[model samples]
Target: MITAQKREESLQDVPIAVSAFSGAALERAQIENPQDIQFSIPNAVLVGNDRFTLRGIGNNAISSTADNGTQTFFNGATVALSPQDEFYDLERVEVLRGPQGTLYGRNTTGGAVNVITKRPTSQLEGFAFGQAGNFDSVKLQGAINLPMGERVRQRFAGYWLKRDGYTENLATGNGIDGREQFGVRSTTEVDLPWAVTGRLTLQYFEEDSSRARETKRLCKAIAVLGCSPNELGFDSPNTSAVIMQTLLRSPIFTGIFPPGGDIYAGAPNPQDLRKIAADYDPKTEGENFIGVLDLSKTLGSLTFTSLTSYSEGKSKASTDWDNADLPFRFLRPITYQLGPDRQVTTDRLLTIDQFTSRSRTWSQELRLVSDNDGLFNYTAGAFFFDSKGRSRFEIWHPAIEFFTRAIGLPAASQHVDNDTPYSRTKAWALFGESYFQVTDATKLTVGLRYTDEEKAIRTRSIVLAAPTPYVVAERDWQEWTGKVSLDHRLDLSFTDETLLYASVARGYKGGGLNPGNAVDPDFEPETVMAYEVGAKNQLLGRALQANLAAFYYDYTDLQLGQRIGANAVTANADAKIWGLEGEFLWRPTENWLFDSNLSYLNTEIGEFLTIDAANPAQSLTTRTPAVPVNLAGNELPYAPAFKVKIGGQYSFGVGDWTGTLRADLTWQDEFYAREFNTPNDRIDGWALADLQARLVRDDGRLELQAFVKNVTAEDNIVSSIIEDALIGSYRNVRLLEPRTFGASILVRY
Candidate 1:
């Protein structure tokens, strides 16, 4: 069963295309993190850790105030932080494809992911699990359920994970991309009077780990000898001269290398994919607290439900934007006397970027759902949400302080630039859906939602000697989206059950401000009109299952990210997408199971003109303008044309223990990382294989397992991005994890 439609229903009976995975299924698939779900689900892609794409629609906005095209939910509540830490202690995960604006209001233009946690039962039960893997990885997880009298129940779950970094920092002699995380959750369920029930849950999570390192794939220093041309058949351009000139003046670089020496000496070897040359071995730290309350009461044939949630989190990070030990330039204003005249000059200082942010969100939802037994059933709901966030970004130049002290002058201010931006969002929505039985075998459903949202931001810069005025921006948006679907059950002699359905839906994502932008700071909302047809079948005495879906989307006013100087802003674009997906499961025998899935996607962008931020005329020094480029007939980012996965499992008996062996192989087609479709933005397709072996006691009280992922150790690039012109125009690529082998033990009581 799944809750893709905000109610309990058999996976095969739902008209929507959804992939559901139980807790046991996750364990078998070795899906230890949210990003792993992309391999198992059709037409779903996760970029980096926070960006998700479905079909061909995705959000690439770098601004914190921008909304995502895809949204995630935890126990019917929208998640405000990264969903990675919530993978543990889950009852099931449901990936819903296509637009879900009818039931899920905003920020669902691509799709929705629902994570449901295990509920407490009126019995005492507990389990403990431990695992150890390569790279000095260790993990421990446990959960306990307790019953307090006949009217109350509670459950507690916690997890701790630590792992060594996968990437090595050559300059700092330290490791990067490591993980150290801890999380705990508590849930309580109480039976109230008058057939009312309430469930309260609280969760806390923290992470203190090394930040991921990016591999530099391109350099823009034309003056440097031995520099090679990139895949675009272009050598370093004159735009890099300004950055090189600043580096030559920095005492920090002069002390290390000869004056006017090779600036590319700190670049990492291109042949080594897992090594980086960053002077700063930065760390990322974050903490989050979440609370949720759910209440429900049944009267007659209708059920009333209320859901409330609150969340707050803070994060700090420092990143090596250059991906090399190169100096970052920061302009400092100074005054000097020349020929008895006062002259003002700007000096370029070496600096590093640091970031800190905090956010809080609260939401409430009230709804009524009628039983599905009647010919006419309906659901109605109202939702309210509010969120606030603040971020502080600074460029600190330690070298400036050192240089000033050496010259017998007042210590230079460490901060060359400091920006603090505060953002807030308030939204409310009303929605209703109804189902009608047109015939004994045919059903028709329709849903509608109205959403009103407001977003605002205030930006302040503290670099100037005098106080600067805050830059404020605000915008409001209203949208009406809905879905209509018709499904029929076929009376077939050869199959147990078969369902055919067709749907048309519309999705919406609200637009927001670009805090510091002086021109066109506000962007327009994006919307998509989707059409789909699907079939779900159960055959061979319910031992075989097959599902197929075909969909087309008309996307308009698509939000796209771009860099204007040092600030990230959003722009509007248009696109069209179509895809076909298929899923199959077969159980040939009691001990054998086979499953496979395939997806084919096609995407094309409508004609639009935008600045090519990666190849500016003159970068850092002068903040030169960038040339505009036309993007037409270009494929969408992260939209693999072809993807397939095949897996099989076999079980056998070994005395008092049951043994199982499983293997899976997945292949994906090449895709681009940007709208430009340049050769440097393309990522080659790759295939991976995973194997697992399991042994369990006959009574199911104990289990042991061994697993290996990426058996071939393929060096695949998972994500890539082009740095802004201010950073010297380079491509940063993130590689997939290398081969890992691990063993696990589980105990139940």
Candidate 2:
């Protein structure tokens, strides 16, 4: 039983810090999406694919309206930054962990994932699945349920996938981050007359990819001068032999150089990272549509609920802004060319772009539940949300439009910039929760919530050589948030179930309009204040189970994110984080099973202010004399200081069929990806292992499975992309995902 509390208790009597999973325990741990459940929880990191960081609080805002702090809900509406593909026919997938802001709000500070789906069942049932793997992969999934005659019911699920491309792009021979996608869902349930009940759901999904593939790490060390290193010496960094001898005495770089060579070459195994030397081919496309509505009524002691939702999404992407696909200066030199009359000296050159986005969302909720078993019990709620979005960018460069048409200008000065933005948001909330049993074994719980928010923005920035377009900005903001909690239930004998909890939470993240600053102004709202303590247990007779938690966070105004040179700004900080968490589950026998989780984190950075995208007049106490960085004690960027997850599983029987085996191990420690902890923002420390085997049949449908993941092909890295070097370090990375093996089959009726 688990709903991570919206009511459905017992997961050892829920006291927070959750991690539920069903759908056959997510297909016996071959978990398919949501970044594979971030390696089974614990400190939960995952940064590059829906961006997450629970214990360390997350949101990496590259501006698309950046706002995240761990939030993703479905059955309770709100799927904002997208990264949910319905996970098949899920019927479970909670995650909870730290701060749920009195029933999910303020993006939960760092928690909330919920996603429960699977309804409509009166009788008839169905299932189907298929799989194939190894780079050229394929998968299919299915579900069905129907029954109309008596109280109605219907369900239908879907999935389809294809994969290929694990990198290998001899420049447009294509094959870079490949995968195709498909999705469908439909659900309906009804039963009226006296007690009332109704449900409805619809979904659709689409994806196309050639997703960005990065790999080019060079951070510093390159003292200029005819930039050397091209002949398979690709540990990258160095390339200026006086801008390649003045671009080979220009004549348009000797008619594009390449026949006697020198278009600023190098890369043909420059330390092969699945090979690359791009010229122009990077991709991504996305689509989504969703809808949900639910209703209930029972009224005797009370029970009334309503939920409504709508979502829309669209995306388009392009990248290859010189991730070393050669074409000139192989590594860095956005600008070059001086002599024999080509002139376009600096201010960086060589860039390519395309980006588009769209979004729409709507939500509504209302609830009132309480059908006690005695000593008070309750839940009350109200919530509403709205969203709208639009974004566009298209940057360009081609020898700076051939040196701005040989220095005459126009032709948009080689089009170096273009932007368009618009955004809107609205929110409201009111909530409550209560429980009290006082004695029989003592019990008490309390909660509260209140939220109000608003945001609006409009922007436009265009500078193809600046002559116009740089003004058309707008901003608006408003906020208020709250939450409080306490829970206790203890009467241990050896623990047959016990819980002790404490809390104080308040979270919010809203503030917008900063399209990389057109005139600079507006980038506030980022708050948090959380403190917690927890314990949950069940022993012996219940086959051991334990959960423990401790937390502290007093983050504020932290909308941090910086890049400066290529413009990606937002700042304001004051952070402090403290953590300790643990979880364990053992079954001993009855087919045996064991689970584990652990985390320890500490992060700090107090009072930080850095929002001078090249001096927007530099006034937050001014600083930035050509790069003077200080973010106090740092350490809050992907935060990872110790993290672990262990696993186990076993089951056996032969003749009539039934067998199982599973394994898991995950580790983490060493993380930084930014927040200016320098050393080029470290990122080492990795461990991963997974394996599985299963077979079943004894008149209970059919099943078969075999799996392997990350087995030891851990390339780690998971996120980075520095960029800011008129001539040397451009840094780029994003790895992980090497070993894989698969097999699957399932059928049910």
Candidate 3:
């Protein structure tokens, strides 16, 4: 039986540009995190900093303020609005592209990602499974669906994953990247007569891992004289800068060694690095509480739905690596916590940390979905929200000589910051669509939305080393956004599922301050007028379905990450992106199934105000190039250019026994950075394969299955980094999990 649902009412009727992946598809692919979605979903890209850019809307460098170009929402509430929450048990993921300010009511200037968790189903069932694999990797998962009779029901699910490091730490005997995650999510639902539903969900995650491996810097081999590698040495207090130059995978980086590279001067391997190391390491913990009360009723011509939700979360994240050399222009003393200035003979480099916010939010939405069956269909909604958040960071460079000598420098330096504000955002919108009767072969959709917002901020600063003590300030701002789009279908004679569409949507992304020492008025919000054309179709007796869309995004105020002197700033740049995304699935011959997805994005910033490569580590050849001049024009990171997935499964019965075999492989093209500035930074894409076999009993009595991932032990990095060679796990590259195999079983009475 094909119990899976292929299409949703939202897909067939909503005028908004969007796409979604069912939890079934996610489970089949063993996608544990949001990044894993990149393989099957199109356009959606996950870059180096765990940042997301839908249709190229977000910036790679994220900050403490809303100035970021992209925003993320969970269950109608904003998650990325602050970064207080983490990815947890999700039932459905919706990616809405364009300005959704009308409904989302938060920082949704660009678009929003809605993660809806599965409510308690009125059923009683539960299952537990465990998997063990190579490299001491193990995963255990369980879920229970319970109906407490009367008016109550609940669903609980959890998983724990522990794995050894993926990258080798030459400095320590152990590998780098070792990690462990334990999380549980519970949802309770109360059903009442007269159309009212109350839901309470609590999710907790405690993840301890050695993350953010350091990067190895590359120096210019101008000559064997002063600035060469020998100037620095690799021993005791240091290593000779000379011999270290030979360790580079590509000798070419030496040629572009700009002036900043001089900071390493006579030091060996002036770059900071991340490696596999044995250290008590840094740990991260996070949690979320999402509460909702929903009320809905249907009248003759209208359906009214009211939703109110409150969410809260707190998180702490930190990572350590080997750092005997100075990482910044201002050399501070390095320490386990931070010494004045000397090589603290500790396990890892700096034991730094951050304690901040994310999920403090409350929202209310009232929506009406028209029940009229006339020639047009529509939906309208009103939303409101408010939030508060703060973050802290501490950094120490134990190896800097000025600090080791305790010359004039202080011990460890730290800063605590925050952005607390109250906002009133409103959106008014209407959408209408109709199946043209005249042509009987066409469908049309027209929708428009307008939004207004009021934003304010209170900044907090605490610096231990500064004599001026704590710094406090305040700021306020506001903006308005609008969007309009149209779609038409041409598959009247074929299938309603097979249609063509061309739409122009105006997207808005609000901007704000940089937080850590921002002096500017504020970054400007972004606006994009995107023109897209696409096709949705099915073939061969409706057993196959596909959707393809190509878009040209013209952006004003494109967001880019840069280092100007010691301050990290975000500015509006002008640029554009053109891309293609498509997906297809074929289940021909009942017993076999094949599926594939392809995506290509050519994105770049045309006019950047200036190129301030002043981050102690790098210096682009030009000093602040002209805005809109195209920086590399490379495929956005986290988004591979091309991807394909092919798989098939067969099932048969022998007497009273049933068995099945399924296998899938994912492949992508070789992807590298536009420029090489660090080690453990590039990857030539490779294929990952998985196989599964199951034994089942016809009575729904018992079942068992075996599975494996990365059957080829492929070593790859899904993220990029600017790593120096001396540190561990600080290499900048976030490695993909290596090969592993495991099995699972289930029993139901």
Candidate 4:
């Protein structure tokens, strides 16, 4: 059973494409975080830490006012911040593919993910689980249920996790990308006098750990002039020449350059993928709090539901931007003369970047749903959401400050600081859906939604002796999105059950402000029209299950981010995507089970011309005759052409216990990380394998398991990004986690 339609229904009966995982299934797979869920789903991938893509559609821009194309919900309420520690004590997770605009509203052009937690039950029971692994990893998780009275119930759950980092810092002999976090949740349920029920939940999470290390992959000296083989032995683009020329033109450095010199003459390029050299070992910390209230009542054949939620969070991080030893000496003329008789001196500097952000969000939803027993049923709802946040970003060059002061130059030339003092989003929507049973074997469903959203932000840059003027920008967008589907059941002799369905749906993401960009302060909203056909069947007396789906999407006004000097702006583009997916489960015997999933995707960008920010010839300090690069027919980022997953499990009796053995293998094709699809942005295909063995008491009171992940020890690059010319011409690369083995035990009361 699942809630894909905002109501309880059989998974095979729903016409939409959705993948659901139960808590038991999650534990069996040893899935500890939300990112791990993607390996089991078809046509779904996770880029970086927070960027999630489904069927080649996802948000690539990093802006204060922009929203994600794929949205996440916790217990029917939208989660403004990433819930890194909420995977514990979950009832189930549902991933709905394609557009869910009618019921989910905005920011779901790619899809919607629903994370439902276990509710309070009228039972006095509890369980505890513990695990230990390599890298000094330790974890503890447990939950307790209490029956306060005949009409009251309470539940509490929490988890603690700590592990050493995987990446080694050669400069400090320390680890990076470590994990240290803890979270707790409390829920209460009460029965009201007016035939109503109410539930309240409170959750808190905190984390303090070493930040992820970014490996610097710099370009070769010859590559600075054009696209050539870089240190990674790939023809990659860089901005070395543009940055050098910009510094040369600045008045403050009139005579600091030699006849022909390279600024990145001594930059370090580490060869090991899991090792980095940096002068600074940064730390990242954050805390979040969330509260939700739900009330429901049934009157005749209709049910009324109300949900309210509020959340607040703050985070801070500091990093060594250069990823190398500082104070690199360079020869400069002291008397403003180009002759050999002039005195030469060396100057050095270090680069550091710091960021702090705080945000609060609240939302309310009221809905009415009718019973599903009748031939005609309907669902209607209204939603309101509001969020406000502030962020401060600073890039410091301490040596430049001293140099500028000695030369009597402005303080603004020494560093760059940008502060978004205020950023806000307000949105409201009205939606409705209806179902009609055309006959005993046929059904028609339709849904519609209207959304109105507005966003505003104020930015202040170069907060020094002479700070730049504050830029305030605001934009409003309205859109209409909906879905229509028809499904029919066929009575065949060989198949015990069979269903076929087709749907046409539309999705929209609101436009947003650019904060400091006055000339292009806003971007247009993005929209997608999706067409799909699918089938679900059961055979061999319900022992075999097979599902297949094919879809095509028409995407327009796709939003992308670009950097101009120290500022970022948004742009619009178009694209098309088509894919086929299949899932199968077979149980040939009572003690054996097998499953497999396959996906094939094809994506192409529509004809459009835009600036190539990574090109060495492009200027970053000023907006001039912009160089145009056509991106027609280019494949979308993270959209691998093929993906396959296969797994099997076997169970047998062991004295007074049950023993089970399971193994899984997954493979993914190569894909790019940017729209340009340059060699530097490509990530090679990789395969991973995992194995597990478990033993449980016949009464289920105790359980023990041993598991190993990434048995092949594949070193795959999960994500990468090219830095701006001003920040140095290089790429920041992030790799997948290394192989790990662990053992766990669970005890139930």
Candidate 5:
């Protein structure tokens, strides 16, 4: 049974394509966070920190007022932002792969991910676990539950994890992509009179980590260096500096690497993967505080529920822009106005870039649900959300002037840019869903939601010698979306556990104002109409279970990102997609189980026209390349044509212990990283294998496990960034972890 439909029902009865994982399954699969869970789900991927994509649709807008197409929920309340916390002491994680806007609220055009935490128990319970792994990785987790009197209970859970970087930096003789993080959660539950219950949870998490390592992959030769692109190596400062200087002289480097190849000095060679020549290691730090409250009361077969939540998050990061260990600079005199007078100064070798953001959000929801025994069952809810945030980004370098007198300006003109942006968002929605039992073997379901949202943005850009400010922009959006479906129980002679369902749903995502771009600061809302048909069945005396679904989507006003000049701009487009998904589970014996999931998707850009922000006069469609090139006929980015995952688990009994072995393999078809559909955009598909072994005491008090992930050591690309051909084109790819082995021990009382 599952709660994906906002009601307790058999998984086979729901008309949605979903993947459910129990805490034990998560542990066995070695899934620790959102980024790790994607490997187990077909047609799903998480890229670039928080960009979660399902099928062929994703939202990558940088505007604070915008929301992700795939919404994430923690304990029935919206996470509001990225929910990438460590997965410890969790009950389960449910992933719905189709539009769920009706029940999940806003920003669910692609899908929804819900993380359910373990609740306080009425009896005393506790567990402790520890792990050690390669790269000097260490992890610790523990949880305790306490019962106070007969009506009160409390639970506390926390985890601490640390690991050394996998990528080596030759400049400092140290590692760069290391990870360090910790989190804690406390929960309190109370039973009141009149069948009322209340619960509150508070959580705090902090992360201090380095940037995801990226290496440059050349597609064209560098004429200035007198060598083919594949012959270059970024492992040393001297070698990279020479290539950097040569590439800087290329005419295509004008707006991209104007000063020279100095910015790419730290990028490592694709073949080496581990070694990079950088002056400084890029570091990122984050902190999050969250609180959630739930109150529910039952009265005469009716239940009312209220959920409230508040959260605050802050992060700061510093990066070495040039990536090289050497100082690469070509001094140039530029004139600017300081105060009321004109000044001149020579540009220095820009090096370090810093970025910081702080945000807070508050939300409340109320719901009324009717008991399911009646001929009709229904749930209605209202939600309100508000958020505010500010961010600062700056870049500068250290340099001493020797010819400041020759240029007419001061030597302290090292600030490349200083930008501060602010954003505010307010939204509210009313939604309801009802199920009607039309016949003994048939049922009908309908749902609707109405949402209203408002957004405001302000951007401030400051240069070393000039101040440029953009006008504050504000926008409001409203939408109405809903779903309808029919489900029928099949009467087969062999088994009664079969269901056929068909559904059509409309989902909506509100629009927002862009901060960095002044030419076109507003984008449109996204809307999708999806049609799906599916069958769920259990055969062979309930030993074999299978579910299949086919779906088509009409998606419009999709929010996509593209690099224009030095900034990234959000654009709207339309697309069409059709796909098929199937999941199978078989347990022929009491101790053996096998499972598999497969998906096939085909998508195309229907209408994608873009305006050149750098040149307002150019209006080029996605099918016609005028500025950033068109992508009208191109396949959607990140949507592989085929995906497969298969696994098997076996449990055996020993004299005084129980042993289990599990293994899984996932394969994906090649896909593109961008909309341009060029050779550089392609990311060839690959396969990964994972294996685990565990042993538990007969008394169930202690357990031990060992796991090996990516056993094949596949160094496949997960994401990439490509510059324009006119801007010294280059491809920077982020590769997956090679191979990792770990072991852990757990004790329970």
Candidate 6:
């Protein structure tokens, strides 16, 4: 049970735009992460790559050094790595938009994504459930409590999920996408008699899915319509000279396929396009661990709480969907056939390591809560954190392969067997928040934080070409970011649940270094200033409660990922982005709820100067990409048009059985582009309806549930864009999944 005081106060009564979704709410929504089909909340748009513009402020980049748009935190521990594989053990999710530099810290010139885990409760009860659905999907989840002693207890839990891959009807008649997952969590608590409590938790999650990180194109050149080998995808050009001409205005050409096709047909198949398209091999895996400790005690007039945590994770995978057939321009063409068609038609064939990454993080935080003075309450804290990450990249090219333009032009630039080592960074900080009750029903909030950060990057690269074809690069960097907020409680005669607040804060994102020739070790930081105002209160005789907020964010020296010289290296440029975002939720009746959100943004580059003004930075115009302009002023990449949702549930009890049925409808206005710098990165808004039914025992402790998601197979692109100069990813097609049904059984002891 929660107290009136706790309910009256928010976790942060600042004016910044933010929303928190609890474990119960998440479970009821059947959502795994922001990638779910629904994109209405906070007027945000989310894509599979994890790029989200809560209010249209973030975008994904091919550059390893680019801002990830959104930074994610798990159990209060910040995770700054490949976010695609970071979802698990979430007890709640917090979406804080605009700039959060003052509190959340860097790389958040846009915003932050936070996931909080559930802690062990003092009880001997537990629940277990199993669910199965379409696509041969099955999942099981359970939680258990064990008593350790009169003053101590333990909590343990685990979950498993298995499903067939979602990809295709194989020409070879086999499942292409299959998956498996297993996870476990344990918690121990020790109650001390000295008014101090201690708790410890250990967690591990491991999964091996048959899904590869990369997707293969299904179209193959069969030559059934008298299609020339070059027309269908051969000519297999070498790229060394082609890239040189791209900016030099030389007569270097790209996009020539081999004599037979774009991809080599393997073995007896004789270098054919059909075989390459069908040769895709898909598989993926992930492993993660987390440890936590919480201790608290009341000392004289101050209540002290300490939280310590550490986490480690590793992931690796492979994809085989004919990525080798990519366009020649992107490949830097020039190649020849040393063997028959399947023997070596093009350099596009990729033996991708897919991707691999490892990370470690540790943090300690201490907080002091002022003794309640009857008229006011407040809190303060000191925090320290350290984090490290390592990753590897591999690209392949063929000597006679078409991508090298037949391999005879200047130096060979394709068929690279390359690898990049891990990059590491660390940080420490102190922060505090206090609320002063100025009057019987009026209160004010003040927050502040100071952080010191240090970062290092280590990388090793080896060239696949002749002579001395190997080189290595290494570097390091650091910075600081900080936050403040104010809140007010309304003096109402009829209803006392009310609050109005506003705030201003700074946000940051770290800089990085890449291996290309023009590698700039001195990448600058991304920063932002956030402003917000909002109202929180209950209305209509307490039958309804609402939270509304509006915010504006100004971004500066935005980090722009750029390609350098002949080596195809990378560097960070300067840009600017700014926007306005908002959200609101309302419950008008016992059986009805309504909510909505919207946002608008403007982004542009103050100056366009390639980070590497020298070296291969010859044609500034050739490199003046629309990434800054493409994404700026447009609704943030992931910010959708306005959104609204209405849901209703009716429940009744009869004899030994009670059941509740619910229906929800959600809608969104058209939103931004999915691809960058293309004329058609636009997606019209859409609406969807879903249903849920729950049957339970008279006591309501045991129950069964059924649900369906995305009832309508809306034929719409989440966002569309044309990847220029290259044939691939021309139109990233994202569609809502058709429909699926699943049921869950729950029990209480």
Best by lDDT: 4
lDDT of 3 by residue, 1-749 (tens): 11011113645344444666666566555665765655555555555535665654555444455544456655554444223223345577676655554345334544566677777878888667666766687877778889999789999988888877655544445555566767777888887677666676666666566543332222233332212221222221222232222222123323322323333333234232333232334446655565666666667777776767666666666554333232223123223334223345433234343444554667666777664556665666665556556555444433332232333434323222222332222223332222332244444544444444444444443322332333343344344444444555555555536666676666666555554454554566667777777777766677887777787878787555554322355665676677787777777776666777767766665634344231222222224433332344434334445656666677778667688787877776555432222222245676878788877888856777787877787765555543222221122345556666777676553
Model 5 agreement with the true structure over 242-353: per-residue lDDT tens digits = 3234434554335434553454344444346566666668788999998899999988778899999998999887766545555443445433322112244535343556
Per-candidate Cα lDDT values, in order, are 0.79, 0.70, 0.52, 0.80, 0.75, 0.54
Worst 10 residues of 5 by lDDT: 613-622
TM-score: model 1 vs. ground truth: 0.91
Worst 10 residues of 2 by lDDT: 224-233
Per-model TM-score on C-alpha atoms: 0.91, 0.35, 0.77, 0.92, 0.88, 0.78
How well is each residue in 474-581 modelled by candidate 6, as lDDT tens digits?
A: 344445555556667776786547678777777666655554445354555666666777777666775655666766566655554433221333333344444444
Report residue 301 deviation for candidate 2 (angstroms). Answer: 33
Give candidate 6's whole-model lDDT: 0.54
User: On a 0 to 1 TM-score scale, where does candidate 3 land against the true structure?
Assistant: 0.77
For candidate 2, give the lDDT: 0.70
Candidate 4 vs candidate 5: which has greater TM-score?
A: 4
Top TM-score model: 4
lDDT of 1 by residue, 495-609 (tens): 9999999999999998877765667677789899999999999999999999999999998988888764455678888989999999999998999999889999999989878
Backbone clashes in each candidate structure, one number apiece? 0, 9, 67, 0, 7, 72
Clashes of 6: 72
Number of backbone clashes in candidate 2: 9
Candidate 3: global Cα-lDDT? 0.52
lDDT of 1 at 316: 82
lDDT: which is higher, 4 or 5? 4
